[model samples]
Target: MSIHHRIATAAAAAVAAVALVLVGAGPAVAGSPHFIKNATTASLDGTSLVVDFKEAGLESGSVETITVTAHLDATFSCVNGGNNVPSDPKKTTISDEFSNSDDFTAGKNGNVVGSLPLSPPAAASVLDCPKGQKATLISGTWSDISIEDETSGAFLAIPGSFSF
Candidate 1:
């Protein structure tokens, strides 16, 4: 071929190669989730606590496992006083740890919904309110939350909290 024709052909080939690479990389990039969004506590009962969260930015299957440590506040305590007495506001603090990976399927905006069961002592601390008073979960601190990513093989730390 002529010199100009050869140069034009080379340039076109390079462009086409780059396009192919980008197209091939789309799936891998789309499968990785970078952050967790809409993470909220669905319910906090004496038995178990459930949290619902969705993956954001990228697609699902990036996070293989999510480990969470939660700090819970017990708002009321039953004092050893007589009947019809007001319950003391003596707050008790408790903690629990759990993990979930069910909702992390191969899709975008994946929802990871799961629960952690409380031990008997832990449940009693939360449910031991006196009569005429309701046992309450005042606040929850979700700390030391880590996610293991399938693509990167890295553990990412995420911290969050909520109040009732």
Candidate 2:
């Protein structure tokens, strides 16, 4: 082949290699959910609600907080507390605190799964009922809420509806 043709072929190969590397090293897209396989699931067992969160985009071994808001249809009056109505009477918010595992690394493109048991004093005050009371969730809607990366001080809000 001519020297000119050989030089052109080498240049084309170099350009293609660089392009592939850029595509592979792309950062995680902003505003995209890091959670996979259903971000959250809440199961009501008797008077307690166990919420499991499966998410990503958080640093390993970091302390993270999970908040859940229950949306109700009307004002709920509980026997064990005061008026027991949310200022935003339509929704009641609850939070669970926990720490990520020492090896729980969900880099920019990974996932971390965690679970919290909402029981007794902590969960009771949220449900607005005394401990051991059969707290009925009532006809309402609940959400996964938010997840924060304590290590990086980054917060990601989990909307009620999301897929993949």
Candidate 3:
């Protein structure tokens, strides 16, 4: 073949090879369906329960809304004259469910790290205590903590319950 013709043929072959490689790698590069990675954690930041998680296989720069849900079991003690009120039920247990949602943007690597905060119920009220007593929060536990992809309505795995 002539010099120019040989060069043109070589360039076309290179282009075709590159195209085939890209086509073969397309699905892998796109990655699997988005999912919440393991090792997700829940902890307390002051009175608010914070859930931290990492979502993998997301589309880069895409936005996702995630919701964190947990059931809170809190204990409060009724006090009168700076001491526990023995006559009244000294301890009261409160159980409730709470959830919070936040938006997270995937990074260039198609992964997102985000945190959502859920506020615990307020301290017990006077109605929870004897007439002359005040209520004080003693301790709290968050159980069945779960993370969900609100956009897809899929629940993700979490470590376990936490205490505060």
Best by lDDT: 3
Ranking by TM-score: 3, 1, 2
Q: Write candidate 1's Cα lDDT for 23-136 as tens digits.
A: 887654444444454453344453344444444444455444544344443343444344332434645666656554432444554433343332223434566765555444
Query: Candidate 3's residue-wise lDDT over 1-164, tens digit each?
Result: 89999999999999999999988875334355345555467788876788888877777777888898889888887778666656646687879888998888878887778888887766665237667777777778888888887764556756677787
Give lDDT per model, in order.
Answer: 0.48, 0.46, 0.76
- Candidate 1 stretches greater than 4 Å from native: 1-26, 30-33, 36-51, 56-63, 75-103, 108-122, 125-164
TM-score for predicted model 2 compared with the true structure: 0.38
The number of residue pairs in model 1 that clash at the backbone is 0
RMSD values for the candidates in order, in angstroms, are: 7.4, 10.4, 3.7
Clashing pairs in 3: none
- Provide the TM-score for each candidate, comma-separated: 0.38, 0.38, 0.71
Which is superior by lDDT, 1 or 2?
A: 1
Score candidate 3 by lDDT: 0.76
Error of 2 at 149 (Å): 8.0
- Candidate 2, lDDT over the whole model: 0.46
Best by TM-score: 3
lDDT (tens digit, per residue) of candidate 2 on 1-164: 99999999999999999999999896554343344436666565544445566666554444444443332231222332343433433334433332232224454444556665433233334555444233333333334544444444445554552211
